[model samples]
Target: MDTLSLTLRQRKLLHILQSHENLITGSELASQLNATARTIRSDIAAINLELKPFNAKIDSIRSKGYFFTAENGDKIRELNRINTAFFTRDDRIRYLAFQLCLTDTPINVYDLEDEMFISHTTLENDIHTLKLLYMLKSPFINITNQHSMLSFEPDERKRRHILTSLIHRHWNYNSRENAIYENEYVSEEILDQMIDIVSQCLHKHRLRMEDTNIVWLNIACTIMYERLSSGYMLPQASPVSKPDASALAASNEILATMERLFSISIPPQEYDEIYLLISSAHILDPSKITLANTCRIFDASVLDMAAEYMELLQEFYHLDFSTDEDFYLTLLQYIRFILAPVHRFSTQENPSISKSHLITELELAWAFQSIALKHAGYYLNEEELLHLAYCISGALEFHFELHPEYKLSTVICCHEHMTVAWSIKRKLLGAYEKYLKVTALIPVNQAKNYDFSDTDLILLTVHKKISDETLGKIIEISPYISPNDIRKLEIYLQSQKVSFLYRNTGSVRSFFETAYWHEDYEFDNIFSAVETLGSEFVDKGIAGREYLSALLQRESLCSNAYCSGLLFQFAMTPAKQTQLSFTVLPRRMNWRNHKIRVIVTAAFTAADRTLVFKLKHFFYRLNKQCDITNAVYSKDELLQLLTAQPDAHI
Candidate 1:
């Protein structure tokens, strides 16, 4: 029987049906194979035709779906084993990619087509897909097909990196048992030995690693062993000076064990690469390790970069992070390994960290990326940015913990009984005790009479029509706070916190009223738009003559375009007064890569942090709620949108 006659999906369907002794529903089979019922029926029909000669068939009952009934079941199992199909396009591409990376000589296209049981066109398409994947995954490595001969870049380090990534990707999707059986490069025994060695070495050095990190290290070492045994060695490069003592010691022991077990001579360059990999893992506890030792591992320039990043963050967030030595050391260590010249480690995606919780940190990470590009000339990817966000998140927690005075002073007013007001206060204190300090509990009827001058916020538990003058400080909440109420409270607290930090006095509507909007405005480019709007602010005595130059300088460093608006701020120093100018272009114009119709240029004093925070939320709403491409918002409409309750928690 020709096992190649059945498609990959068909073979998988056959395997599923063969595993079941009784009847299996077509829907069950469809779900298992991720196919439709009709497709499963078609696949069953195709499989039966292939099995007709062997007297094996998948029969169907009237209503109970299908069952596998074969005259000789062993023949069908043999056929299924022989086919061993690559199920999806991704699977095929991964297989071909590994084949290309492992081979020293170029593989003929026709030879690959025959081996994979695919047509010439299919193989060509797979090659095209592989090129794109490699381009994104490892830009340094190039895949070429000259004269229908397929090969990749000859750099052993890149090849090994790609190989390790592919292995990890596969392991992520499949079970460990399946991964053990499917992995073709490293034997089970050798992988086990490598894992054992890595675990013991890390334990001996008091270096802690996550279980997944242990697997990753073992896989990397196993790949190194295989590559070395095949006579491929990493090219010698400048060694990392003053590598982490703990990681270096651990890498040395791991290498020694592998050398003895595999009977291969691993070079010093490989040890350096392993040291970098371990350092990049960031398993060293900052509390356990001293700053001096950690500082010794990084270059002076990297330490300077870390300091610059912290300063930039402080300036942007209006929060002081100078006293957090642990935060500084963590950022320094990450920057050191990330900026390494050789064997730069790619951060893996951490599924456990919630991106929503890291919104503030993510913003900080974005700013960090801008500065990193300006100074270091490297664009951080999403995963790398996420890693930075986690670090920043920890620092922010520590900062808030150390400085409880930063918390907002609050008074809870309720129209209900005294018990209800106390209940509300309990919930608020339970949830945000760190963020809020409840100053007083007042009844709704007596709320207007009491003095709230010292309180930063007034949380009313009942509906009360607040006067426009005090609306900025009042937020209505339910007696039993809902999640939505919590989110609104969070934003309010963040805005209020920034307001307190900057000593902001203006209302949200007043800030919006100060904005100058130009309808049907025309500009050839972003520079012209900035000049026209910035000069208007200068003419209004809201900004200095250096405002335009500062905007241009910031543009040169990083484009200010975000969402459907170009936000240009002259934050060199606090302005005497705040001014905002907005232009609604008749048509969308290209600003960097963003298609923006709204040009917003603002000159904000250092005390306008609340306005800056609100403006950010306003633009976010402007993008999500309004169709900037076609809809033209009037001044009142824009003001309304700006003052609307923000849905996202700051």
Candidate 2:
């Protein structure tokens, strides 16, 4: 029997039988191997057949399971020599891909079947999967030939990509378990000699490569040259980009040394390909982000675009990231890498397919999209958006670390309404736990009895006459508080004079009056709902004719769905002053991707332009609290949840 023909499971079974001198039950074997008893029986039969050649047999009785009787124990030890079957599926794929890329002619499937210890059926399935998943997806790999034989079609750049991907997956940087030593293709002596020669050449030319990168470069070159020796020359690469002078000098010296070692002359185009791969494995230096280097790396247009994007973020968020030279330089470098012809690395899987997963990234993208299009003439895809978001997140984290005292303290008063007070407290705490804290929830009737020394701001549900001696920094608010209130609270907390974007807290409360909430309005499509609300705004002399058009236009630009079943639909830059309204659908209606249960529309005004950002942030935070929206059945319940005060600062 050929030990190379057995699977890893079958080999383990053989060793198990050889170790036990007493009778072993099938159930016991099954439990030890984590397999079914029926499977154990089948394995026993297969093992018996393989052992027949060694003058051994497993004998079974009616009441017991089985026992092994062999004339010799040495034959059992020979089975361990076949260790190839222990490879993982990815390991097998990498091995197969390398073999196919290096071979001069089509390879027979049966040869791989015997050597890999995999059944022909499993081999065929893997090939089919590789052809569809990798070959078709990549511009590099092409599967060729039919059932009798098959091979990877030859191409220069494509081969490098395949080798690089394989190297990243298998090479252990800290261990000797490297692909060059593991494979039978290249000898250890040859690989070591090549590494010494390449390292000397790089050092002579003042070029630097990390130890692991040098290993990868050596392995890649070994595969290419070995395949070249077998009469398999790679197809010439496409028109080349201008080579870096230092890299070109290093590649030339390396090529000269290889020629002396192997006794073969190299083509100039192949020399460029080697240099290109060397540069692709660049070891980035932190100093490369200097202003002088940034100018050298990116074109003027890219720098201009970065400036405009940073300026827009500053204007909107009032955070001057533009002054952070590292942020600006890094963003410029990332844009250049994104626009490069050939990626530095091989195939990458895309993330950010789910909107809920990348909240901060999506927020930044939405805020930057219009500005980007105005200056750069392109919109950021999810991949680029996530990359930019990381840069911004890092910068923000560093900035916050330096200013650790940025926080807010708040208190609320709603007399004779405990449910309203509790709901308001819950929503505020959930949304602003990172920055704002609620100090107390006081009843207006008992306002004079509570201590108000630590309170930074006070929010009341109803506007009632309270003496200045009793109230401390009080702002009357509606039970259904709007984001405008939050903005005022933030400005006051920072000790800045309130800007035009904010209104007196009493005015904000008036906008949320119960009259503005149209209880009898029929819920239809989003457009119809907006039109019905817009007409009410015009009837009350609060807005003009263009309000409906502006609201629909904003909705079309992006989905107004803030949460799973809630829509925070709002009109931007409306023709008249801002006002707030709400309409609850009697039955669910499809508004874009969301199933609309409630529509909260706001007619935005120029005076409140900065306040819109705060509102957007509020709804963005609400997107994560879908359960809060789903639990509210009546107007009062909704009001209570939205008005929940935050926790007190301890």
Candidate 3:
């Protein structure tokens, strides 16, 4: 369908045509669009091109003005794609947030803690910090759980950021600034210091310096190098080569079926180059490992250490890294990421011949993981982590906005009966002044009933249904116009491409099947300070408010993370902090019109406002986690599934 390029007026007419299942008159469309009936008729003539593909036509009987003239699965799919691609910013963020595809977990938390005597709080804070930082630095992002886990999305914009960071950032830090050396060697002092730290830590069961770990120490070097020296950036795919052409061709093939199935075309060649680079850059080719036969990068010890590193990483993230095929790609990517700088540092004619120490270091990480995986660190995976990084970067890149092709006009169609469309239009254009050259708005109903003339795209509410008649009408008059639901419109604009840009939560909900649910069921989880096996207060000196306060303080200092829907409000028994404790209250709730029975948890401090974080996080998660949203929302079962006795409290 030619729906990707329609103007505001034509689109508005299409909207009106579709509003009625029966034939719609041009006069009705003119009334809805607030334009002259003569102008509307001219627009009808202008839109015949859109109806060509389906072998359809738009009709205009003296009184009957214009309506779609075709019917088929092709048209349906075209409407479906248009329906699916219009997601808001929160939608994308939420989409990424709730996708918990981590193959490793728990251990990541522990390792981060083990490094600095960090309470779970600090580790969580670090994760949050990384998220904010990453969002600030890139365009493609994946922030899972708002603040708990992270990942970088496979977006074209992200590829650009990666290229820039690589080209402008350094990769080796254990060197004297600007002091070039032969064969990737660092300053003599740096080498000596590293050797000394390793020797001391290995010799002394523990190091004497401030609490830290090999990973932290290693990070220091990796970050320092990237900062000190510019890394390499791949050539823009536009300056095509054999590689670029090949990547483009491959991407075209992949997109072919999706396009064929839906009758929707993606945003253009930009993605073709990006998909190619992503497929190849991540060692995605099964054959990348085959290159290994040419070089023994490591002996058995290296493999052994990798096993250990994998284990340690598993603990650090409280997730397992080896349980699924997805993790294999993720794992390979991690290994490649961890060793890239080192590999690059090698100056030998056959640098690949000398990449063994990096292998050893990886093995060391696995050594920690090997120490019995924990339930917590069994699900962390690299892509998800990168996803987190991706969101941080994209959100942060808010300051940089410009699109090379395709100018846009935005419409804000909310449920509000009143018109806020003008404000929405202004804000959207202002937000992307770099790319948005024009703007306008109409009452949502009007916008829905009539699209903009040359309105190329739109934003609408999530999961809203696009009926066949309505869609067909739009296609007939303005198949080039893209519809975006207002609720998530802000987010939809930032997406690299839009096959379909509207999400009406009402109708879209059916795409996802419910895993589990209850209409009015309730469950309670109780925790009490009263003791029976032992006296209530045995001078453990950690009972009541004081204990909770200390824990909370530590959490604040570090940042605590809980699985799923929870934010521990431990202040109910604290002193250093105000009285607060977080608990999940699973109850029936509706978000974006989708009903969900969830735990509406809150935290309390004497002075802190009710724990609004729960609501905030929930809102954020809702938009990003379309696929996993149902699952997370469905886990509110109150069954006492375990038989273990309660823990002893003093």
Candidate 4:
């Protein structure tokens, strides 16, 4: 029996039918598939005709719509198998690119047409279209011998990148239920093993890494290792010196594991190369980077670039990287990839510009490119600039994540229907899961009955007549959320000036301890000053040794130093008791590559923990002013600055 053919549309119809066992009306099917009722009737007739040899039939009910009935389930299964024969044009093009990338020799166009089940004219058209793409212009794709033959011109590094991107795209598409294709150059088992090795190494080194980044690193390593095993090695532009003892050890461990898995011996220089790759990918111990160690791995130019980038960021946005050791190290590592001789090519188009809050992101990207040109003597392409914007977005998310206690409380009010309110609430939760907490959902009629005292904003689905005070707090929004609405809300949320999440009812002055105060102290480094402050707190019996440990741990993640020579430090969790310490060092001391002279350390009990973040925000505002940081010298001067916010209502 001949297997029945199906177009993609008919296959989609079959999928929708299989999902719903009950009867559906012709109009409902057409609505679901975005077609007319007449078209749906014709498709049903075609479906039933194909099912005639099988056990299945598309049964039509007069009013209730349509349903599929299977007289013999085995025959229905055969029908499905035949529908799987249909392949997309995109699938064929990707397969052709994959084959071209993997093959060492040139491919005949006619042979490809036969393999892909396409006519010679269609194949030629596909090739012509592909050649016009920006990705194929590079050292990767090449057309030779009068455009009749095609070959992948490999620069080992570029090929590895292209191969990894293709593998990831394929895996992401089919990972849910489909089996890995056998024709892939690198098998699933090998990729999985490589991921395992990288995972193990990261765990052993106590490095903090995100899972997405780990997967990317794994793919990159696997492709690079595969290329090297196949005797394709990109020439090293610069010979690598022996790596840092720690990085070398980690790299050697990875090499040993890879050798066992692939049964291939790697050269010694590759050890350092792998270490460089790992570090460049931002998979490293955050605390391990210090002034002494940073110089060893990075050149003077890289450090200068990192500092310049931070300065530019501060100028563009009020972003403070003076004490962000992790960000500095990340930028340092990232610059290597940017400055490397190997040019990166992307087959995919930049689609991030279409996302919500794109205006703000693009503004940031433009600032980034402008700064890069000014400071680093380099300019980023649209794709690269978008990537930088992503990095900035990630950093912003991390900033809020680091302070999860500070969520913007929101209340949704909808008088139309409960479903409308529920739908809006669901969207709010999904969209702002990290930065917002939807406190309550109430109908507009019953809004007065609920407590909205704690809520930051009252979101209304429609215009409402309310008191002037209530109107000030209310923001009218669409019942169906739009991207522009989200952008406006995000901007409004950031601009909101509110009290701390964990504020104490007592005044800020009440949290201070007299014994913890010091004036005109002299210290050349941050470590000695921290130790001295810890001793004072311990002797006063206000905080334990754990408090100092937490403070040091926070510093290790990033410097607590901000611009204009002020340092604000706090722990993630509150201290054993509430004690506020003030230390004033008049001498400019080098701290985390920044000059710092004044330090404020607040140790708050969990009960008064809200004060920590409020104080941090207070310092952030203070850091923006040169007058406060540069002019304040005496305890009274600093006290006046801190207490000036009497209306803060702490």
Q: What lDDT does each candidate get?
A: 0.68, 0.60, 0.34, 0.60
Estimate the TM-score of every prediction: 0.60, 0.46, 0.23, 0.47
Model 3 Cα lDDT, one tens digit per residue, 259-293:
45335444344344434332333222344443243
Q: Residue 256 in candidate 2 has what lDDT?
A: 82
Ranking by TM-score: 1, 4, 2, 3
RMSD of each: 11.1, 16.6, 26.7, 21.0
lDDT of 1 by residue, 199-225 (tens): 789889988765555666778898998
- Candidate 4 C-alpha RMSD relative to the actual structure: 21.0
Task: Point out where model 4 deviates above 4 Å.
Answer: 1-86, 119-125, 132-141, 145-147, 154-157, 170-183, 201-239, 242-247, 257-262, 265-276, 287-299, 310-350, 370-378, 381-384, 394-650
Q: On residues 411-458, what C-alpha lDDT tens digit does candidate 2 reach at each position? A: 788874788887888887675554446777778887767777665567
Clashes per model (N, Cα, C within 3 A): 0, 9, 161, 5
Better of 1 and 4 by lDDT: 1
Decoy 1 TM-score against native? 0.60
| Stretches > 4 Å off in candidate 2 | 1-83, 86-88, 103-133, 136-139, 144-151, 176-181, 184-188, 208-216, 237-243, 280-289, 308-320, 340-342, 345-390, 401-650
The per-residue C-alpha lDDT of model 2 at residue 259 equals 84
User: Which of the two, 2 or 4, has more lDDT?
Assistant: 4
Which candidate has the top score in TM-score?
1
lDDT of 3: 0.34
TM-score of 2: 0.46
When 1 and 2 are scored with lDDT, the better candidate is: 1
Residue 460 C-alpha lDDT in model 1: 87
